[model samples]
Target: MSRYDYRVRRKLFNRGQESSHKDFNSFERKYNQRHRIQRASRFLLILIALIVLIGIAVFAAKADNIKKKSAPLESEKELAHTKNPL
Candidate 1:
């Protein structure tokens, strides 16, 4: 009769608790685990790719320096050959 409904609240609070099965497949939990693994794998892949790219850039820079240092010596050798006329 009053605005309060104790019987209704109690029925809702304890209703069908025992009747529920323990299957608990719980779709959200599986999705969360799968999503976490996917994210971790993607991050790891990106990290490895960045490391490989950095290594390649370092090697390319070193190769350029080596070529630059050798080019001058090659030009000098060519000049020497021209002066010798042989």
Candidate 2:
């Protein structure tokens, strides 16, 4: 048989061969815990950034509204001054 055609055999684990399996399970658990913490922190960072952006947008809108309201009052004052010659 050619080397390329030969299949490598996988070792079978018996009931007494549980050490490797337990080690792999512990490693997998630790890896999953670290991955979960990283994902949660990333999500929280994005949430806080979005909240800050929304707050800035709200403040900007309020400032624009204040400017608009003041403009009409100034125009009304000018009209009164011109009509009263003062």
Candidate 3:
């Protein structure tokens, strides 16, 4: 090939490589941004789920306590019967 033709071919090849590199960089940036958002959302979802579970556990514990308090023990019932004698 002639020297001029060789230089032109080299320039065209370099341009093609640069464009491809730029495209790849753009795609990588978009993918990374999407991945970061997904990760953040996943973390948030897990946190919310944990909070909900904790709330449910606390509510269950409170309900159990209420149920226990609403009923008199056998000893207390007997003591009441003795006191009233009715």
Candidate 4:
């Protein structure tokens, strides 16, 4: 090829390389942003699940306490009735 044609081809090749590099940088930025958002959402979901599990545990403990409190009263009533000969 002539020197002029060689220079023109080199310039076009450089321009194409620059455009492709910019495209790659744009794609990388978007991919990183999407990955960050997904990580944050997963953390939030795990936090919410832990809160719900703690709430359920507390409720179950309270119910068990209520049952314990009522059990003695029921046993006393049974004992009192059984003591009398009918």
Strongest candidate by TM-score:
3
lDDT of each: 0.80, 0.83, 0.84, 0.82
Q: Per-residue lDDT tens digits of candidate 3, residues 15-70?
A: 43555456877899999999999999999999999999999999999987784456
Candidate 1 lDDT by residue in tens digits, 1-45: 889764644345456477454445666788789999999999999
> Total clashing residue pairs per candidate?
0, 0, 0, 0
Question: What does candidate 4's lDDT look like per residue over 1-86, in tens digits?
Answer: 65664343434456435554568778999999999999999999999999999999999999877844435577789998999899
Any idea what lDDT model 2 has?
A: 0.83
lDDT: which is higher, 2 or 4?
Answer: 2
Model 2's TM-score against the true structure: 0.53
Over 6-28, each residue of candidate 2 has an lDDT whose tens digit, in order, gives 65768645656555556877899
TM-score for candidate 1, residues paired by index: 0.49
Q: Model 3 compared with the native: what TM-score?
A: 0.53
Can you tell me which runs of candidate 2 are displaced by over 4 Å?
1-22, 68-86
Clashes of 1: 0
Q: Tell me how candidate 3 scores on lDDT.
A: 0.84
